[model samples]
Target: MKNPCVAHRGWSSRAPENTMAAIRLALADPLIEWIEIDVHLSKDHVPMVIHDYTLRRTTDGKGDVKKKTAAELAALDAGNWFSQKYQGEHIPTLAQVIKESVGHCKLNIELKTDGIRYPLIEQKVLECIQAYQAESEVVITSFHEGTLYRMKRLCSQIRTGIIIDGWRNSLPKELKELGADFLSISYSKLNKERVELLKNAGIQIMAWTINEKRAIRKIAALDPELLICTNYPERWHELRAESMELEVVNRKK
Candidate 1:
């Protein structure tokens, strides 16, 4: 099991995070196998891809994302904050992303729940995945316990994951109880011992937001199956190329 790279927010270092442009760009690359994005329900109950509960950070709109309809959110410019080149890039619906990624790669959709819990978001997400029969193509995750629980109960066929920002000694038991297929954690909290504990628990680890060359290598070395979630997939790809080159040079020597 080689440590695989998951493009975080879809090559976010180069494009706007969670936009269709970023997602498409990552999918275009033959090297990207998995991509992670955030999903929030609009006022009309459509699942849209964007990180925050509010739209101010990534869009020209200035209010809670839940207040707007999917079309309304789509009208806002989601890509200009990163650069003018993406000025007209709008927020993409989860269905659009699923349709776009049907044959390309897998998606890890994070259910965004900051303060207010969007009612029936779980059902909406399940229905969306079911509409496409994409149980294998999508994995739903969230920091909220109840969201994941509802998702598992609704459709056990689709995988569910926990987005953890901290560690606990009883985490293995907790994850097992929650029926998490995988767990994504901060890179700072990941180490060999923690990886072993989860592996023994029959759970997979996916480390988040690790960008530096050395840090990515350090974490990937711990477990070959570990999913190295990064903003720039190119860095990881470059590291692999460099390692192979070094291996060749060493053989020659």
Candidate 2:
């Protein structure tokens, strides 16, 4: 099967990250099979699409996002910081994201919990995915192994990915117990030896935040099952073609 190419945090290169515009742009691209997004609950327990715990980085507002209601978050200008063209984009809810990309692109929801709220996060995320009937296309990912464990019990059918920021040999064992389908880790955390080690263990590996072309080529040579990149989805067609051609030539032997 052709390896899946997921847009890290949506088509973040063109639009504000985690906003509806970024997601819409990602879906419009034919190369991306999945678009990854981050989720955090608002003060009222509504799931909103965002990457950070604080709104100061991505929006006009300045405070903990969890402390703000959906209405307060909506009133902030999420786009102005990126550029003036996107002057009024509001923070999107998880429901809105799922509804818009239901059939257009697969969803990779990364749970960003500020507290020990795994149960609520799992329930709310699954509820949203189920409401949109996006179970087959949605994959839940988290840096926390506990969250992955909680998610598996809630919905066995949904695929789960474990996020790692550091190197560890014991990850495969943990992933197996959690029933994780994939491993999503930072690009710096990957090496040729590590890639082969995980691949041999029947785990899919995906590296994140890789925007440089040379880095992409090097990682492509290592042959990960998926590449969750921030700025390279547009070039996926080219990269995939090169990889496939190499595979074909090698198969002739």
lDDT of 2 by residue, 1-253 (tens): 2556778778888888988888888888877888889999888888899999899999999988888998898899999899999999999999999998888888879999633853488888899999989999888888887888888888899899888789889988888888986888998888888988888888877788777766777776677465656566766667668778988999999
- Model 2, stretches more than 4 Å misplaced? 1-3, 114-119, 237-253
Cα RMSD (Å) between model 2 and the true structure?
2.9
**Candidate 1, superposed: residue stretches over 4 Å from native:** 114-116, 250-253
TM-scores, all models, native as reference: 0.95, 0.89
TM-score, candidate number 2: 0.89
On residues 1-253, what C-alpha lDDT tens digit does candidate 1 reach at each position?
2578899999898899999899988999987889999999999999999999898999999999999998899999998999999999999999998988877899999998743578678888878888887888888888987788888888877788888998997888877788886898998898889999989988878899899999998998888889999998889989888878988899999
TM-score of 1: 0.95
Ten residues in sequence with the least summed lDDT for candidate 2:
223-232
For model 1, what is the error of residue 2's alpha carbon versus the real structure, in angstroms, after optimal superposition? 4.0
Top candidate on lDDT is 1
How many clashes in each structure? Answer: 0, 0
